[model samples]
Each structure stands twice: as structure tokens, then as C-alpha cells.
Target: MKDLTYRLPQRRELTTALPGPKSRELSARREAAVTAAVSPGLPGWVVDADGGVLLDADGNSFIDFASGIAVTSVGASNAKVAEAVAEAASHFTHTSFMVSPYESYVAVAEKLNEITPGDHAKKSVLLNSGAEAVENAVKIARSYTGKNAVLVFDNSYHGRTNLTMAMTAKNKPYKTGFGPLASEVYRAPMSYPLRDGLSGAEAAARSIRAIEQQVGAENLACLVIEPIQGEGGFIEPAAGFLPALSQWCTENNVVFVADEIQAGLCRTGSWFACDQEGVVPDLVTTAKGIAGGMPLSAVTGRSEIMDAPVVGGLGGTYGGNPVACAAAIAAISEMEEHDLAARALEIEAIIREVFEPLNGQDTVAEIRGRGAMVALELVDAEGHPNAALTAKVAAECKAQGILLLTCGMDGNVIRLLPPLVISEELLRDGLNVLVKSINANS
Candidate 1:
């Protein structure tokens, strides 16, 4: 494995207070220029980022508990990725894959085809974002199966596109006011081991029963799922649940599409989170961490299913842009040479190590996640979701120079998505802040 040579300082340092004068001025300007709909989770504006730290306009360097919403697995600006991007940009930025082909695009496709789950001859369609990849996956699935229904899970988070928004389980913020969503999108139960008392088999049976009764297996084109639901608070579908669902999809000819957008590309202890369970998805959509924050996504699957779409059925103007493809090539190379999957496991171990002491705390209902994508679900004394405490804890951590993010429909989950490249020292320091924050908030 290649040794890390992090350029940024390893420790959190604050030259100014939380949102300092410069960041506050920028925020004020941003309010006037940017859309109100675009929520800035952090009050400060970022000027630079490297390794596991984000340097804001305020000169406050924060330990990045959230890796740009899990997009920068190899670190926000890996030297290798930046160098590749610069070289690619110098040659040609974009001719559009449809207008003119490039080797970098083809190389990225080849890498994705080789790495993604499943051994069957796989074909990939590249896009600019997770939403686009998902949209294309649906198109491919429907084309292959000649079916209209697409099944997504409750508490699942897909994307913001029209079809993907309908696929998403949350109604507010993401789905609200987005009227007349795409049709034939069905919501099914997910396996949340903490919330539901059912075993993996039982959860699978429950979901299957719902799918069979509501959206019949014959009518379904595909079952799009996150092996680990990201916005649903990093919920890992119970063991055996995914395999059973995959088996069911196989038996019924349903295209089981695993949305590994936030969980893939070595962010979750494995190349893909589906690898943990050996769940070979017929169609797997990937993005986010795929290009080390270069805005590249792909839908790779069995060749037969992927080929169902006619010529020109799936091509995007900016999809697989040479620059992004170059970044992807570099990012994948870094992941391989650095053994990022193992790094993700090590990150998870560090997080769990810090969390073990707080295991019995009532406010800390559950501490879960695989690899660097971990979360703490906070609940009140009555065992109800405690959004208040969650907010407080995050605020306290941020004040102390740790950047943590909250998720879940109820907004009670504090998710930690430190870059897989985070050092043991920075990770432990972030965890220390997290622990202190949670204790004070509790």
C-alpha cells in the first residue's frame, strides 16, 4: 500500500472563532447570490481542503468528519487526482463523449467494469452525478425487463432528480413541492436492525410480502437499494437481508440495482458495500466517491441488461468528461495502491473504539456504520428521536473545529464520514471532540 503524505497539518487549528469575520461576510454575500434552497451545513465558507481537514475562509481548520458529504474518500484534494485532472485539462477539457470519444473515458469504463460487484460481462454508462446514474439505471432496467415498476426502500435516499426523488422515501425538503413525480415508483420496507425487531430473514420476508402484494414481482423492472442507506442514517440492511432480496430478484427476473453512490469506491470497508455480503447486484449505480469529488457516476451491470437500451438511448453531454475520467482513474489507482478498503475498516475500528465506552448511554441509542461511514443515532429518555440533542452535539463539535453532519428523516442521526485517508491521530482527535460534544449535549 502506498504511504500517505498528507500536505495539511494533522491537528485542528483555529485562528479565528467558529464563523469568523471573513466567513460571516461571505455567508452574507452568499445569501444574496445563492438560492435559499441550497442549505450550507457549515456556517463558514471553505477556501482550501486536504487530507482529513477543511480550511475555511475564516482560517479555521476543521477536522472533516464529513468528507464533502462522502465524496472525497481519498481526501478532498488527493495529489494524484489533482495532478491527473491538471494533465487531462491541459490536453482537452471536453468534446462530449458523443461528439468525440477519448481514451480516458474508455479507461474509466474499463476500470468500473472490472472493479464493480458481479463477474458477468458488465457494461457501464457514465453520467455527471448520482441522480443521472440512477435515472439511466432505471432506463436500462425498464428497457431490459419491459416492466414499469421500480422499488425503493422506506428511509432510503436516492437523489434529487424527478425519478430519483420519487424513489426517495423522505417527503419533506427532497420530495415536497416536487409535484407530479415519475410514476411506477414503489416504496418497500428496509431492514433496520435497531428500529425493527425482525431478523434478517424476517425483514426480507416482510419486504418481499409488501413488494408482492403492492408492486407485484412481474410488474417490477428493478429494485434500487443502497447496500448501506446513506441519508437514511447509514443504515446497513441486516445480514442475509440483501442476499435474500438478491435471490428473490434473480428468481423473479427483477433487476436488483444497488445504489452504492455514497457507500462505494472504498468508503465502506470494501470496494463496494455490497461486497461485504457478497451481494452481486445485477445493476449497480455508483457516484460521489468514484472520482474523488470530480462529479462522475456510472451504472455498471450485466451486459445483457445494460445493452437493452437502444443506441443513443443513454448518453449525457458531460457524462464521463475526460477531466473527471482522469480523476477517476487516479482515484481508483490511489484506492488500490493504498488499500483504502482496509483503511475504511481501520477508520471504523477507531470510531467503534471511541464509541464502545458510550454504548450504554441512553441518548446514544445506536452507534453504527461500516468503515469510515459511521453514525450515532440519538434518542431522548423516552426512547423517541432526539433531534434537539443531535443538533446540539453537532454544534458543539463544530465550535471546537470538528465538522460533523446529521441525517435521517427525523434528523436525529449524527453521521461521521471521515475520509478513508484520515490519519489515526486526526481520527482520534475528531472522535475525542465527538465524545466530549455528545456527553455535554446529553
Candidate 2:
């Protein structure tokens, strides 16, 4: 297969208005063909992306801060990942692992096993998405413990699947009008230091007490949590909260599951965010950045817990596709060779330099996050969530040829998930645009 010849420039340049004429044309076609339930984050239609640059249909170049929602840590079109994907596709594309296995599948699993939080003997089962990995993790936990209850926290976003919808905290968009959701899923308070004014230990105590009173530990199959809560405003629980919960789970024999779908794969300057806290979970669900934007996910954990489920209990036809596996292998290599984890730390410093000063401002409530996965929480004069302001800033940034993403329970957060390989110059330019927009909107 021949490859595209154009070299993507690592800068932001807009030749036309926000949508451009071609993008508006494509938008019309999408309106007729695509469902209204699905929405595009930006108006521009992406034609190509490399490093931190996105080329849209109208020839407008954008600086990427969304990184496809943290999936492209190695960059949108890393040479190694593209080459591996093309080579693998040339050989063969699909042969369901359940029916006919391939070496790439095992290789991906092996890599996951090695990179996940623990040093203990571990095994992995690949799947199609983060929600699938989470569901399968619950199944494995239940199979091993023979329990019924699953515990999650406030402001958590597991996925949109039936089970995850029940696990998720938000109701309006994700769970509303979809009643009779999966049962036995319970919610507890999460550590929001800014909101609660509590220390890590205090937050953990609050959460543990809620779990005990609401759902007994003995009855819980697993307690799933995000080390650095992603959709929940990038709230990194206070230092001791995770360790405290982990210990409680160990004492109670409840499987501690870390949902690292967004914070893993070196996005947080560590292989897994759990590593930063020295809290090792029994089962970890990873996706998003794992395969460099490929549709792949995995549940990697202790061998005993992973093996509890029957041979055919966990897998999908498209799970661990060969081409995706090849991409993962190459993506992991790029992460290691370039020490992107360290680069994430550098990115965090740059972002913090820009956002930290605005923390106590009228419109900026807080600034929090780790490594390359950072965010700014917007609030009104009375400290209430200012979703309108957040929307305005993101829209203004997009209009200026910089892509940004927003997330939060109240939709008042601007998250930064820049590609790990983004050049310092491009990243600074994007940040400048974001700051200008925020100031302009505020």
C-alpha cells in the first residue's frame, strides 16, 4: 500500500474560517448520514495529523491538545506506528483470536503484563474498548470472589455500555432515559480536595465509611477507581486516598481495580498513574493510549484472578486485532525510546507555568492533574461551575486553529492531552492561544 506524501507541518495556521468551506460541506453530508446522538468535538474535518499538528479539509492547520482524548501519546501519526500498522495490514488483518490466534496478540498481552503496575505474575485479556476491559475486569473479579457488588466513585466515567452506564456518575447525557440499568453497581464519594477541603486520609475515610455502610466489602466483587479521575475533572485524589483504599481492599479481599484507561501508557509521566502513588491494584483496565489510537483495550492482573474466568468467558471477535497489536508494539517502543514519560513531566511544567497563576481567579477555580494529562476547572464569581465560560474558551481556541477538549461533571473543565511527541514550540503556541482565549472569554 502506498502512503500519503505530504509532510505535516508542526504549527497552527488557519487559511479560512473555523469550519472552512470544505468542512461545512462535509458537515452537511454528515448531518444527512450520521446519527444526531453522536457529536463532533470540533467543526473542522480532520484530513491528516502528525505529532501535534492536525490538517483539516479546508487546509487549516491546528495544534492538537486533545490527542484524540489522550489516545495518541506517541503522536497522531508516529512513523513507527504507521509503518507497523501498514506492514501488518499487508500480511493479514483479521482472524479472531478465539478461533485462530496470532503472535501479535500474545505479544501485546505480554507487553501489557510487563508494563502494568505490578511485578507479580500477571496475565491479560485484550478487548475492543475501555468499557469492555472494565466489564471483563468485573467479570473476572466476580468469578474469582463469587461476589455481586461493584463499587465506583462520584464523577467517574467508565463508559457508555449498559454496565458502565450504571457505573458512571453523570446522568444527563450518559445515563438519562436509559433506565433499568445494570444492577448491583454502587457509587461512593471521591476525593475532591478543592471542593471538600479534606486531606487524602480524610477523603479515604469518608469513602470507606460510605462503602461499608452502603455496600459491605464482603459482598463487593471489585472496587474500581481512576488513579487520577479523568472525566471527573482530572481530580487526583489527595496523596493518601488511593493507598488507603488499596489497603482497605486488601484487608477485605475486594479486588482493587484501577481504571487507567486515560491515565496509563505514560500519559502521567509513569507507565500507570497507580505507580505514582505506590498503590498496586489487583486488576487494571487500560485502553486509549495503549495502542496509539487503535481500538484496543486490556484487563491485566494477577494470574489467579485473570484465570478464574472460563476460557471463553472473556473476549470479542475484534479484540486484539493483529494490525492493532502491531501498532501497540510499535507505539510502546516509541514511548520507551523517547522516554515520553519524562516528556510528559516537562509538558506538565509548561502547562502549570501558564495555568497555576489563574487558580484563584474569578473564572478559574483550580488547576490540577499529572504529567501531560492536565486540566483547568472553571467557576463563576460565586464558585459555582461555569460551563458557559469553559465552552467559550474552547470554542475561541478552536476558531484560532487550536484544538481543545472539555470535561467535568458540570462540563466546566478544559483538559490538556497534548501528544507526548509535540514540539515545545508548537505546544507553547497552542498554550498561548488558549490563555488568550480564556482571558478574552473571562
Candidate 3:
């Protein structure tokens, strides 16, 4: 293994208020120039980031637990990723893969094909974002099965695009005012064990019944799901839920697509969350952690399904940018060399060690998730969503110089997506602050 070092000190430091004077000035400028729709989580005005620390313009250092929405699994300023990006940029940046092919793009596809589940013959198509990868996965499924209906789950968050918005379950911020979404998308019951109190098989049966009664199997093109949901409270389905769905998709000829955009690439103690249950899908959509902060995504699947799309029917001008591909290659190497998957397991153990006892608290409904992607579901004494307390806890953490993120349909789940390369001391400090904040808010 190669020796790696963090560029900045791993401690959280506060020299000014939450949104310091510099951040406040930037926020004012942003309000005037940028639209109100583009709201940032914390007005920190980051100037540099390394390891688990984010240095803002106001000279405050924050412990990063969000990982930039799970995009920088290898750390924000990973040396190998930076070196590769600079090297690739010096050579040539853009020569659209469609117009003039590049070796790095093909190399990335090959790497993805080899790492993704299943030993069968497979292929991959690179894209610019997770939404595009999912959209293309659906397109490939439709082309292969000649069906138009897509099946998603309740409480699922796919993307913000027209088709994905139609597939998503949340209606408030993502779907509101963006009506007239794409047609032929259906939602089914998900295996939420905490809320439903049903076994894995029982939940699968319920979903199967819904599919059969509402949208018949013959009419469905694909069944898309996030193995460990990111925005939907990091919900991990019951143990046997995924396997049963995979079998059903096989029997009905419907493409099984695992939306591993946020949960894949070592974020969940494995290359992909689907691997935890040995559930191999026909298609897998990947992004976020793929390139260590670079914009890149891909859909890897069985050769026949991926090949179903016509030659010119797929691809974009910046689908497989060379620099992004290089960054992906180096970031993948960093993960492999450093064994970040195992590191993720260590992070999980640290988090659970600190948070497991909170399960008995009246305001804590559940503590669930796998690997580095953990969530704390906040609820009132009557078991109702306590979004108010959740927001307060996050605000308090931010004031203390710890960057936290909240999610869930009701905005009552606090998600922790620390970079896989984060040190144990830094992660524990962040968690300690979070626990104190939760206790204070409660």
C-alpha cells in the first residue's frame, strides 16, 4: 500500500460565526446574482478542502461529514486524482468521445465492466451525471424489452430531470412546479422494516402484488432502485428484499436496474451496495464517488441489454471527458490500494459505537444504514416525524464547525457521508458534536 497524508489538520476549528463575515458577503452577492432556487446547505464559503477538514474563506475549518453529497469518497483533494486530472488536462481536455475516441474513456469503461457485479460478458456507457446514467439505463431497458413502463419505489429520490422527477417519490422541492413530467412511471411499496414491521419476503410480496395489480409485469420496461437510498433517509431494504425483486425481474423479463450512484464505489463498505446481498442487477447506474469530485457517471450491464440501444442513440458531447476518465482511473486505484472499502467498515463501526446508544432516546426513531452511509431518524415522542428538531440539530452542528446534512421524505433523517479516507479521530469528533447537538435540541 502507498503511504498517504492529509494536507490539512484533521481538527475542526471555528474563528468566526457559523456563516462568517466573508460567507455572509458571498451570500449577499449570490442572492443578487444567483437565483433563490439554488440554496446552499451551509454558507461556509469553502476555499480549500483536504481529508476531513474544509477551510472556508473566513479562516474557519469544518469537519466534513457530508462528503459533498457523497461525491468525494477519496477525499476532496486526493493527490492521485489531482495528479491525473492535471496530467490529462495538459495533454488535451475535450475531444468528444463520439467525434474522436480516446483511450482513457475506453479504459474507464473497461475498469467499470470488471469491477461491477457478475462475471458474465458486460459493457458500459459513460455519462456526465447520475441522472443521465439513470435515464440511459431506462432507455436501454425499454429498447431491450420494448416496454415503456418504469417501476420505482415510494420514498425514492432518483433525480430532478423530467423523466426522473416522474420516477421520484418526493413532490415538495423536487417535483413541485415541474409538472407535466414524463409518462408511464409507476411507484410501488418499499421494504421499510422500521416503519412497516414486515419481513423482507413479506415486503417483496406486497410490492409484487402492487406491480401485478397496477402495472402488469408485461408492461414494465425496468425496475430501478437505490440499494441503499441516499436522499430517502439512507433506507436499506430488508435482508431478502433485493434478491426476491431480482428473481421477479428475471422471471418477468423486466430489467433490474440498481441505482448505485450514491451508494457505490466503496461508499457502503463494498464496491456496490447490491453486492452486500449478492443481488446482481441487469443494469447498474453509477456516479458521485466514481471520479473523486469530477463529473462522471456510467451505466454498466449485460452486453445484450446495453447493446440494445442503437449506435447513435446513446452518448453526449461531454459524456466521457478525458480528464474525468483519468480522475476516475486514479481514484479507483486509490480505493483499491488504500482498501477504502475496509476503511468504510471501520468508519461504520466508529459511528455505531458512538450512536447506537441513542436508539433509546424518545426523539430518535431509528439508527440504521451500512458502512459509511448512516442515518439517524428523528421523530417525536408519538413516533411522528420531528423535522423541527432535526433542523435544529443540524444548525447547531454547523455553528460548531461541523458540516452535516439532513434528508428523508419528512426531512427528519440526519445522514452522515464522511469521505472514505477520513481519519478516525476526525470522524469521532464530528459524531461527538452531533450527539451533543441532538441531545441539546431534544
Candidate 4:
């Protein structure tokens, strides 16, 4: 394996059409063997990657803007991440964290404790995915608080697992037929300033009132929230909402959990999005971007709450795999050394400078977000959401070689989660492409 500080390569390259012949062949074989419902929307195959460029199997190279749904914070094919993964793979790979403890696993947990918010003594338990961490968090909260119900926000996206699906508020794509989900999950209103006419305090009050009335504070085990709702449209709760909710949780003995899976690891210009509001949650769940693309998730929280679950209740056979833990350690170190949080702020600045002017335009409704975790919602002159326009803009950006993703409950928001390590020049170029796409669509 190479040294951890090695750098990445330059921009994209393309010699053949996207999903070149080789990729097409492989994709066809996959379609034949696997369910077509799980296929990805964009180019489906990647042969190799270096720096920000992904070389597809068909001899096409493309700049990766999605970052694997905000997982690869350092950039795809980061040299340090690659070296770390290679080194870990060369060592003993699997020893279930429960069966035999390993240094990397514990080291990763320690890193999470130090990096996550609050000076309180924190303990971490590793998991394989964000949903697992969230699920375990509920289990711990219930065990500790002796409560039956959990409170989740509307339009929130936790994960695809059954319990998480029940916790998730979306319907068509994620929860369509997953009937009779886990019981005792209650829904609450999320404070979306863009659509909901309320300030942070007002929104928080309204949501808390609903929770208190519907579930009764004593019956609530935990209140789980996404500091910046990922699939719910990159929505940042009203400024005071989080702090207010945290205080309420404290007084009511409800575990305040922040699901920072998509908003952590400096993607939101902060170590965790909860930091934006100066809110310290009892439990913080993180996964995306933690291992620079490796599958690793964790639930870090107050030591006592974490200890609520009895011994044997909190692990998986593959939880805390050594390689993923090693990758997490290296990825987090890289984030710190490179000051990715500051870079996320820089990215946000660039985005605001480019999109702020569009705010008052008939085709643009609102430009909102914190740090690089930014989004813009499209609306018509009458203030109706223009999902069609957003879709057109995204397609145009893709055709012009700039990748983008659309999100939000109405599908009218454009979210940007570029790698924090992307060069300023390339970043600006991509933004320019986005502006052009929006203008053309308008």
C-alpha cells in the first residue's frame, strides 16, 4: 500500500459514450441475474477512479459529484483512503467486534468520541449501516428510559431497513408496501423554513406540542432527527428548533438522537450539523462519509445510555469489521488534516455567490443550506413547486458532464454534495454548469 498522504489525480476523461460497451455488457448481465428495480439512474459502472475522475468500463471518464450519496467526503479514489483500505485488506480482515475485540475498531470509536459534539464522556458502538445505528439507538433509549414510543419527523429519511422505513416519512419509493412496520414509532412535524411559515422557535414549539399531545412525553423513548434532512431535501431545521428540542428531551427524559449520517464528517461545514445550532444530542448516529466510502456506521452517545442495552444485544456478525474501522480512522484523520469543514464552508460560499441572485426569480423559490450541504428549490411564479423544471435542469447538467442530484418531498430541490477535496477550479466549473442548466431550463 502507498503512503496515506498521497494525493489524487486530476479531472475527468472520456473516450467512449457513458456506460461504454464493456459496462453495458456487465449491466446487461446484472439485469439478467438481479432485480432491475435496484438499478442506479446514472452511469451504472465504474472501472477505475483517481482523484475526482471516474473511468467507466466503457472507456469514459466522468467527474463524480454525487460522492456516492455523500459517502466519499475526501473524493472518490482518494490516495490516502485507497492506501488505508489496501493495508487493512492485507491484514486479518474479520473478527466480529463481539467475538474478539480489535484495536482498529476501538480506535475508530475513540476517534468518533473525540470528534462528535460535547465534552461529555461518550461511548460508541459500531454498526454496518446508518439504519442499524439508528435502530440500536432506539433500543438503547427504550431500555434506558423504559418507554414505548419513538418520535421521528415528517419527511425524514433514516434508511431502507424495515424499522427505519417505519421511521422514515417518505411513501412511494421507500415505504410503499412495507406494511405493518415495527410498532410504536410516532411522527412529528419537521421545521422546514422554506415551506413551513415559522421561525426556529415557533416551529420547534409547534412540533413539540404535537409530540406532547400525541405521544405524551413520558411514553417517548427518543426523538430522532436529521440535523439537515438528507432525503427530505437537505432541509436544515429552524435555528432554534434543535436546541429547544434538546432541552425538552432533557427535561422529559427522552433520548435526543441526531441522525447525522448524511450531515456529519464535515459535509455540512461542521463536524456534525448539530453543531450549527449548538445542540448536544444524547446520541449521534453517523455513517456516510465516515470511512470515505467504506460501509461503517456508529452510534456515539452518553456512556450510561449506551450501557443500557445488555451485553449481547448490540452487535452484528460483521459489525465493526476491521478494514472499515481502519478506513474510518484514516478517513477521519484526512478530514482533520485537510480541514474539510473549512472547505465545506468555502464550497457553500461559492454556491451562494452563484445562486443567491436566483432567489427572487420566478423559476427559483428559495436558495437555502449550510456549508456544502446546500440546496435550491424551484417554484413557479404562483409559488407552486416546479419539479419538472428541477428534473430538466438535472438532466441537462448530466448531459453537459456535470452530475447533480434532485431531492425534497416535492422533488423540486437541487442538492450539491461535492467532495470536500474537489479542486476549487473544478468546483466552480461544475457550478457554472449548474447555473447554465438552470438558466436553459428556465
Local distance difference test, per candidate?
Answer: 0.91, 0.91, 0.94, 0.85
Residue ranges of candidate 3 with Cα displaced over 4 Å: 1-4
lDDT of 3 by residue, 1-442 (tens): 1225998888899998768899999999999999999899875999999998899999999999999999999999999999999999999999999999999999999999999999989999999999999999999999999999999998998898899999889888999998899999999999998899988999999999999999999999999999988898899999999999999999999999999999999999999999999999999999999999999999999999999988899999999899999999999999999999988998999999999668799999899998999999999989899999999999889988999899999999999999998888888889999998888778
Assess candidate 4 and give its TM-score to the true structure.
Answer: 0.96
Error of 2 at 265 (Å): 0.4
Candidate 2 error regions (>4 Å): 1-6
Q: Candidate 1, 333: how far from true, in Å?
A: 0.3
How large is the C-alpha RMSD of every model relative to the true structure?
Answer: 1.2, 2.9, 1.3, 2.6
Per-residue lDDT tens digits for candidate 2, residues 1-442, read 1112235777789999778999999999999999998889877999999988999999999999999989998888888899999999999999999999999999998998898887999999999999999999999999999999999999999999999999999897999998899999999999999899999999999999999999999899999999998887899899899999999999999999999999999999999999997999999999999888889999999999999998788889999999999999999998998888888998988888876557667888888899999999998888899999999899888888888899999999999999898888888899988887777777
TM-scores of the candidates in the order shown: 0.98, 0.97, 0.99, 0.96
327 in model 2: Cα distance from truth in Å?
Answer: 0.5
Q: Report backbone clashes per prediction.
A: 0, 0, 0, 1
TM-score of 3: 0.99
Query: Residue by residue across 1-442, what tens digits does model 4's lDDT show?
Result: 0112314344555566665778788889988999976967666377666545556666666666788889888877777777888998898889787888889998999999998999999999999999999999999899999998999998899988889999999887888887879889999999988789799899999999999899999899999999899888888877798999999999999999999999998998889998987889999999989998889999999999999998888999998999899889888988999888988898888888877657677888778888778888898768898999999888877665666788988899998888787776667778887887777777
